[model samples]
Target: MKSFQELGVSKSILKALDEIGFEQPTPIQEKAIPAVKSGQDVLGIAQTGTGKTAAYLMPIFGKLVKAEGVDPRAIVLVPTRELSMQVGEDIEELLTYSNLRYASVFGGVGWTKHAELIEPGIDVLVATPGRLWDLYRAGAVSFKKVKTLVIDEADRMLDMGFMPQIRKFLEVLPVKRQNLLFSATFPEKVEELSHEFLDFPLRVEVAPSATPAEKVSQYYVAVQNYRTKLNLVSHLLKDEETFKRVLVFCKTKEVAEGVFKVIKRKSEGEVKVLHSNKGQSSRINAINAFKNGEVRILISTDVSARGIDVSQISHVINFDMPQDYEDYVHRIGRTARANEKGTSISFIAEDELFHKDRIQELMRADIEEMPMPSEVEIIPISKKEKLAQLREIDKQKRENDPDFKGAFHEKKKREPRKHPTSFNPKSMKLRKGRKDGNNKKR
Candidate 1:
């Protein structure tokens, strides 16, 4: 309940926050700002939409005071280009009353443009791991002036396989700089990363790691098959008044494209689809459109789940369960952001029930199951689809229990066949002759 002023935020930053209508600090910010100001390494565990970005940035801004050199004094590393852009925007907003220079660099655009961006010098630099490393190798940026290093969304960076680049950064950056690592969830791998990244860091957490936002009303609808899930989504969107802005998350690009096509044909609103394969400009435009309220619905894979920071998303629909249980938290976190109440509806097929159970276990709460709407058409599962579902279920079981050999595995087990070289034509002819002689004698 403490105000930003009471938390020891500077007068200029306070004015900027006030202009932006930010009256009070969120739980994470309230606890983290002071620890960060202490100049000790810090580890933060807070879900998305809890103002963790400001928790670190505000204190860092207070330390920077004014721009000093051409090279960046602080580097903020994120997992995706979208996140890099978002953090850069946040820095711009926070430094509204100051003269600090900052630049955001990521792939998808020409490196020359980014090189031009940092040429004049910047106080803060936000970038993805690969792009940052590339810029450094090209001699466009320097680490000697970087007094603070922030690895935001550490879990996502690890998930995206950026650990090697992160380690390389650790090797190249100054050892005397402050380290701040933040993540939505703290898995075993993240915990290991923390040990390597932080120096006796003070840990701050707003909630238990991986817990979904309490304000989000989570629900699930059981469906017969994939097509039925699509039917249910289209049917639910028919009530446009309640489902004003929605994010539909799929497990893969193909499924996201299918959902996008179905929703576009059935609904009368602008819809966009985003995946890794999409062109970078197209993906950025789609996200910007959705954020600006020009597009009502967006279908995307988990790649965009953690990067999106829109606060007014009315609903989050899981067209397909995420392969990683931790992603379920990030997907739902998209809706209930900025202390706004939101809803999350998941389509649970037979094959996804095991994943649903695992996610519920991680959240320590069950998602309310809803009866299928009477208007939605339920498509029957084909034999091929049914077999595929069974096989997927078997795979899930084997992942949890190595001793588990499901029915499909049992059926697939067969005796080894003879090699082509093992054929014997002479023996076959002799046996045939003996059989003919016996028949003639008879």
Candidate 2:
């Protein structure tokens, strides 16, 4: 329970922290700030919501705020554009009253805008690998003056195929700068990179890696198809007593919107969807509104699962299971923050069964299966209705299929060809017969 003031932070930083209501430091922050202040390399192992950004940012600010020249003394690298924006914003706020100059560089924005920021003496450069490399190639960056380097979300960089770019950045950057590596999980690749990058790094971990939130009550509901999933999700949301601010995550942007439409029908007007398919301003607005409690329900792809710094999220509903088990951890992490007990309810259908099982094994968590609501409450489709649909399918088959049950005269069914030859009109008149008079003779 050490306070930020007791951690040897200067009076100015203490004043700033107190103004921001940051009195006590979290476990990770308390342990890491001292090491980082001492200029020792740090390999931090902490989850996203544990105030990791501040754990590193506080120390960087404490050191860089008093810096004289702005030759990119500190470089903080993030994995995604959203994360780059978030971290840069966090730094900008803490350094608002100070004379420090910071820059945020990411893709999807014009390179010209970034060129102006980097050209000036930026004391702290918050960038992604791709843009950083691009700027370096254009001779707009001078890495020789960097004093501290941070690679936030190192595991994601490796996952997104940025190792080569990371290698190149390392090769070009100054050798004697401090390195800070932060990630929730330490895969083999991240561990290997830390060895190559950091010098005598001190490892600091506040929570066990890969462990889901304890405050998050997690369970799953079994269903049959997307239609069933939709029905189940809508039914779950109708119970206002349980779902307050629910976040539904799908694997892709299309599924996010698709599920959003299905759920919005029951929700009337409280539901909103966010995905990459939307324009940048739209997505940013949606996320901001959700974070501000303007939107109580948000349906999004797992892209928002990473580095979205929103607290007070009551429940996280998984409309579609995640492809990687690690994603399950990140998805649930969005909820159950700020010591607030939350729930992670997953909708497990036939298509998501395999993914659900793998996620279970990865987290080493035994998921309690929740039964669907009573048949009467949820209005299950009756057996008679299902049978009638099957009957209609059979009737359609009999009518449309001329040789439905007979063995194919040709061994292979006619499949759409990759590059089918053109059918000549003169040679395609009839198939060995004239049907008009020949059928009457038969």
Candidate 3:
């Protein structure tokens, strides 16, 4: 209910906010801006579309009145290049009236451009942990003046195994600085890392972590196998009236590409695929196409679950359920943004039902289940899919009992590694020595 100005935001930022049409602060922003301005480390937990990025940035910009130092004043460590770009763009939008400069450094691009950006010095730097560490180690960037260190998407950083990289940054950064850790979800591991990174940080939670947006309607369709799931996706996308501006999330890059191919062949709408395998330019183009409405459906892996900020996303279809339960919240968060109502449909294969139940348990709300359409053929499972399912089942068994070798484990252990008997070089020397000894004895 409070305006940005009422929340202690400066006149310049307020003017820029007005121009950007940010009429009022979101719940997380309302709570976080003050805490950040108080010069205390903050552990902020809110859903994806709640403007968490701006929450930290506004305060950082408010305090950073000018570009004073050759080194960056604030360093925002993100988990992905897409998020680095997103945060950088958000900062640029908020700096409409300020002379402060910020650069987004991430992998999948030439370091030359980033070196050039860092050489001139900037007030803020948004970066992925690995690339940022690389730049700093290469002496292309400095953090001596970095008074504020932000670990955005801390949970995702842990998921992507960037804790080591983040730790490296912590080692190199000044100890006498403010630390802010923000995340959509706070699993135990993420919480542990937050404790390690922060110094008596003020905990801020606008909504319970793993809680999906209330405005988004969630549903799931039961399918027998991967092919059936693809059929279901194709069927749903055909209904353009409701599924406009849709986003489909797959569990892996292979699944994402498969879904994209199937949808491209079956549906008449424009479609794009996004995954780690895609080139940076292709990923950017796909995201731009989706944002600009050039593409009606965007199929992607979990990579885009947190980075994308497209409003009016009519639907987010989980072509494959996310392995991480927290990612379910982010996948659905893609829709129902900016106070708009949206829908999310998930395709649950028989093997993925347990994952679905885990997600529901985390959300404390069961996703409404819908029957698969009769017309959509339940295709026979391919050998590859069958093997994948077996592997998943084996993995689950192993999780319950570490001693449980997988379905293929016994076969692998029993199978003999072949070595040619006639060409045993290891014994040939002994045989020759024995023959020589026999000759000498004779």
What overall lDDT goes with each candidate model? 0.92, 0.79, 0.87
Give the best candidate by lDDT.
1
Give lDDT tens digits, candidate 2, residues 1-442: 7888788776666777777877788888899999899898999987657788889988888787664564788999988877888898787767756777888888777787799877767888899898988888888888888889999988887888888888898888888889999997777888899999899999998876777777888889876556677777887788776787888899898888888888877774477888777776777787788778787789887765565778888889888788767778888888887677888888875446666777777777877788888741444656665565455445545555856643222256789769547967786655454556564422
CA error at residue 237 for candidate 2, angstroms: 2.4
Could you give the C-alpha RMSD of every candidate to the true structure, in order shown? 3.8, 8.5, 6.6
Instruction: Provide the global lDDT of candidate 3 against the true structure.
Output: 0.87
Model 1: per-residue Cα lDDT at residue 291? 91
- In candidate 3, residue 11 scores what lDDT? 76
How many times do residue backbones clash in model 3? Answer: 0
Error of 2 at 66 (Å): 2.5
Which residue pairs of candidate 3 clash?
Answer: none
**Candidate 2: regions farther than 4 A off:** 375-442
Model 1 CA deviation exceeding 4 Å by range: 410-442
From the highest lDDT down, the ranking of the candidates is 1, 3, 2
lDDT of 1 by residue, 74-115 (tens): 999999998998898888899999999999999888887899
What is the lDDT, from 0 to 100, of the residue 50 in candidate 2? 76
